[model samples]
Target: MAVFKEIFSHCSDLVYRKIEIEGRQAYVIYLDGLIKTEDLQNHVIDEVLARKQVGQLSVEKVEEEIVTVSAVKDQSYLEDAANDILEGNAVLTIDGHNKGIVFSIPGYKTRGVSEPDSEAAIRGPREGFIESLRVNTSLVRRKIKTTNLKIESMKIGVQTQTNIGIAYIDGIVDKNVLKELKHRLDRIDIDGILETGYIEELIEDNSWSIFPQIQITERPDTAAANLLEGRVAIFVDGTPFVMILPSTFWQQFQASEDYYDRVYIAIFLRVLRLMFVAVALMLPAFYVAVTTYHQEMIPTNLLLSVAAARESIPFPAIVEAFIMELSFEALREAGVRLPKTIGQAVSILGALVIGTAAVEAGIVSAPMVIIVSLTGIASFTIPKFSLAIAIRLLRFPLMILASIFGLFGIVVGMVILLIHLCKLRSFGVPYFEPVAPLRFSELKDVFIRTPIWMQNSRPDDFVKENKKRQANDLKPSPNKNEG
Candidate 1:
């Protein structure tokens, strides 16, 4: 008891209740705010007191039958027991015995599972991951529903002692990837990991790169789908988002809804997403380059209108584009930070009002407004937020290049970007997999979604053994009788 107090620094909320158990002195210790009061009273205290007649059998009964919890363990070390007590668990220690029983009964409130605000699904399940790690693992387990699906857990942070789980399939997951993942995780010597992003930063291929080498998703279906594709998932305890490992350049453009929608619809949406990603990255730069240097690229009438619009503005084309882009970025950040109900209204109204006011005030050309708006829309078409952010970040550099060297600068920036992407790797797998390496066989689900039957194999770059995801010749055929 004195040691426990010393460890917790005599915190008032640290609970320690001494009582008789089997006629020997014993005590139950837990944190006040961490535990369920009703559960402790009904399951532990009341049950122990009610079994007073059991006499010498009380400790035995408590260990064997009395406490009605799914997880109960006999712990030996004080440090382990203390850790459990701090983690919303109850520890019963007898006076004479050094060993104690630890009960798992965490009961602090958490937000209920609801539709993810960031990754909204139109046709698929509306459920999203909650902050609770156990709940999130349960969600993944529910989707996989196989004995082969495994979740290995460990404590990460030194002070925080945050629980982190590595989820993968037993036979399907690449042994090399799993080993490498565990190696990286074991090598993480950080004090705390408040979110999965911390782990991602620590374990991902490149921290300085703008492109996300790992994918993050709140949807269990997406995580499960990736797991089935011979990937690994890292689930952080407190955060709603889970990180999927070995994410490629193309994977960032994919979404759960792509699999949910019809094949043709999915293909069309994917092509649009690919097109828009380019637009989002290059549109402002293209506009700046054309207006400032290459007037012939635009139709004569459109160029005249653009010239007329910019005539009243004091800023150059590049300066006008920068001002509008920065303003839109500010508005986007404001919209995201504001309360959800008013966020959309503020973003839409703020953009429209600001754009109109800026054009009327001759602060920016109307053509700049149109270009910025189009760029923003194109960015929104991207399915992954991390990738979208990376694209948004690349826009400024590309715009600067365009301003300095016009079309030549834009082309140079793109070449550099592509070269960097091609050079990057996620855990030894190329970031621009199948595309850069030119695996023609694995292109079935890249820019377009072939029918499920046609996608009979996983990407050759991902797994060594399980390259075949499904059997051959599963494509549907018309019956002879029908024909």
Candidate 2:
């Protein structure tokens, strides 16, 4: 038992205090700041030491008469004490024995509850999930308000021992999905899990794929919504971004705000986002294709204007496009790295100066600058950063294709991407929902969000047991006479 503490050197955080309990020597050990000192003093230490009742204090009797606590149990000496201390639990040991008892008393200071920045909404609850696992789980439980919302916890990371939880509705969630999720998690053996990404990378079906099959979100509402839809939510101890399983490629384009607003507004915004997504992914490549190999495809007036813009330019259309794209990417990266006070100003000024100067100097064509700028803006329309990155990265390959074969290259690139999407799965569920399988009913929330009243059921691909969201009879509008 003592060997473990010697190995650890009783790390500074592991507080070990020696005292006597009713004339018998004893020791109290716990992680210093993790366990509440008040609880240990009043409920455990003082109570045990000041006790008047004497018959040999068996561990059970000590718990019953002295500590009188629910989680108090016997632990074996220094090794047990060390483990308990590391786990944020308190441990007690009596003199002359190689054993001790562990008491469950965990407490640590944490950040105050605040609004989620990534998934913030203009009209909804502002509260966000904090880093604490217990608090995050409680937030989910508060929203669910049902015993069927099961939360299964496990410790990962051999060195970090980070607490991770898998939550889903018991009967609604498919058992196979749950089984696979647990199996993948059990397979992870890392030194520490500092963020949800650590678990995400380990559990994903394909590590090499750039497109994420799992959806990670900071909003509890988003997590709760997914849970009710029979999806599993994974909460890591230190990360606010909880991960949702079985995420479809189409799902990345959808946002929590879609469900919060009117059907018409939601549908319009969704369509607008979808259009932007296409533009974001293919705009640069299309520019490269048409300018390099398919100039005839351009409208006559547009082609003349493009030719005029490039008349003084030294580089070809492809090189001009590449320079502008790289400049925009650099400006965007600088904006992210700079402080908030100066970031916007620097990025905006940098882009305007670089783009205008490049065009005037004939280093890049003016029309190519406009195309690159639009592509950059279009990428921002995507709600998920991961998806936006995927779009950005694919742009380069698509550009190479365009340089070689024009429109044919764009078509081939898209085919490859679509095929990959069709092949991908999120915990055994298809990654391309509705479109690939052609579930007409589920289209309500995919490309264009259907009206709330009309969306009477969850996605058909997911929760088969509880298909309906609400009864079909409830409609928001009434006849003119009734009104």
Per-residue lDDT of model 1, residues 406-429, tens digit only: 999999999999999999999889
The per-residue C-alpha lDDT of model 2 at residue 460 equals 65
In the range 32-93, model 2's lDDT, one tens digit per residue, is: 78887887888887877676554555566667777855787777655546767787888877
Q: How do all models score by TM-score?
A: 0.97, 0.92
C-alpha-based local distance difference test score of model 2: 0.83
Lowest lDDT 10-residue stretch of candidate 2: 52-61
Q: Which residue pairs in candidate 2 have backbone atoms (N, alpha carbon, C) closer than 3 angstroms, thus clashing?
A: 75-100, 75-101, 77-99, 77-100
User: Where in model 1 is the C-alpha error above 4 Å?
Assistant: 21-23, 53-58, 478-483
Model 1: ten consecutive residues of lowest lDDT: 51-60
Highest TM-score, which number?
Answer: 1
